[model samples]
Target: MRFVRYGAVGQEQPAVLDADGELRDLSGVVPDLAGGVLADLPRINPQSLPRVPGNPRIGPPVGRVGKLVCIGLNYSDHAAELGVDPPDDPVVFLKATSAIGGPNDPVIMPRGAQKVDWEVELGIVIGQRAKYVTEAQAPRQVAGYTIVNDVSERALQLERSGQWTKGKSCDSFAPMGPWLVTPDEVGDVHALDLSVDVNDARMQSGNTDRMVFTVPAIVSYLSELMTLHPGDVIATGTPPGVGMGHRPPRFLKEGDEMVLKISGLGEQRVTVRAEG
Candidate 1:
């Protein structure tokens, strides 16, 4: 099933995509899609619910996200483009939950920011608690998948003297959703294609097959280091073609537009703007 949250930010109501691809109100069936609720999504006939009147705003599929964990350079080709070798272990980092925003929301550029970049990635939404789980047991802990635009500020990320989180945790930096596609709905997660475009120009195109770390591998590995709770989101790294990898290097600016898509998870079209 494809679950969603539709309405205004903070007022988003739970919804599910019906067979006809219409949004069916799930507010009467369940609460917001988050935490323990994700582990046991009710089995319902979407057609029986009220159809959403029109195209309301779609918020991040998962609510009250506990953590936005990310894996860096998980794609071998991405590591190659950056002139580095893939790490033996997943490169883990954390993006502040405050950065979470609706997929279509505007991305705000930080003051004095330079080298803002775009990374199209596949996001894994955790369903159940996991700790020291093996790869074989990891599948049961996953609820679904979503698209993530891991926006970054290279200056603060690589030039400044701090971790990547500083450049990554700015509000509106983590645009996710459109739908939270269940594993059963998104068969073969490793084969999904993902890409990103800036202002209608294709900038990044790659597949999950190129990932140095697979989905279950990432989940299992992360569980070993920290407890994975329901509603935690893991951004499996981006593919090659980031603005930073361009010949002359490209970066986002005010008024820019971004389009991100992953095979069955759905798409995100966002506008870029300067912060007040």
Candidate 2:
């Protein structure tokens, strides 16, 4: 099933996509797709729920996210573009939950920012607690998958002295979801294609099949280091062709528009704006 959260920010209502691809209100059944509730989303008849009227703002599918963990350089080609060798293990980082925003929300370029960039990634939403889980057990712990636009500030991320968090956790940096698609609906997660387009031209294009660390490997590895709770998200990492990897090193500017998509999960259309 493809689950979604729609309405205004902080006032979103739970919903599920029907066979006809219409949004059906699930608020009557579940409060929100967050915390422990994700572990046991009821399998009910979609037709029974009231149909949502017209179009509404679509918020990130998972709410009250405890942790927005991100894996850096999960793609070998991505690592190469950054002039770094692919790591033997996952390069973990964190994006503040405050960075979470709706799919179509505008990306606010932080004040004094000079290197805003885009990264299209696949995100995993944890459905249950996981600790020391093996690769085989990883699948069961995932609630679903979503698209994540891991926006970044390269100057703060690489040119500064601190960790990547400072550059990665800016407000409106992590735009997620149009849907949180259940595992059964995704068929093969590793084969999905991902892309990012700036304006109307394609800037990034890659596939999950090229990931240095697979979903199961990433989930299992992270579980060994920390407990994975429901509603916690893990952005597996982006593919090559980010603005930073361009010949002249392109970066986001105010009024720029970005369109990101991952196979099956859905798409995101966001505009860039300068912080007031």
Per-residue C-alpha lDDT of model 1 across residues 137-213, encoded as one tens digit per residue: 99999999999899999999999897999999998999999899999989999999998989899999999999999
Q: Please provide, for model 2 over 1-276, each residue's C-alpha lDDT reduced to its tens digit, 9 standing for 90 to 100.
A: 999999999999999999999999998888999998899987988999999999999999999999999999999899998899999989999999999999999999999999999999999999989999999999999999999999999999999998999999999999999999999999999999999999999999999998999999999999999999999999999999999999999999999999999999999999999999
Error of 1 at 135 (Å): 0.5
- TM-score each candidate: 0.98, 0.98
lDDT of 2 at 155: 98
Model 2 spans with C-alpha error above 4 angstroms: none
- Candidate with the greatest lDDT versus the true structure: 2
TM-score of 1: 0.98
Worst 10 residues of 1 by lDDT: 27-36
Candidate 2 lDDT (Cα, 0 to 1) = 0.95
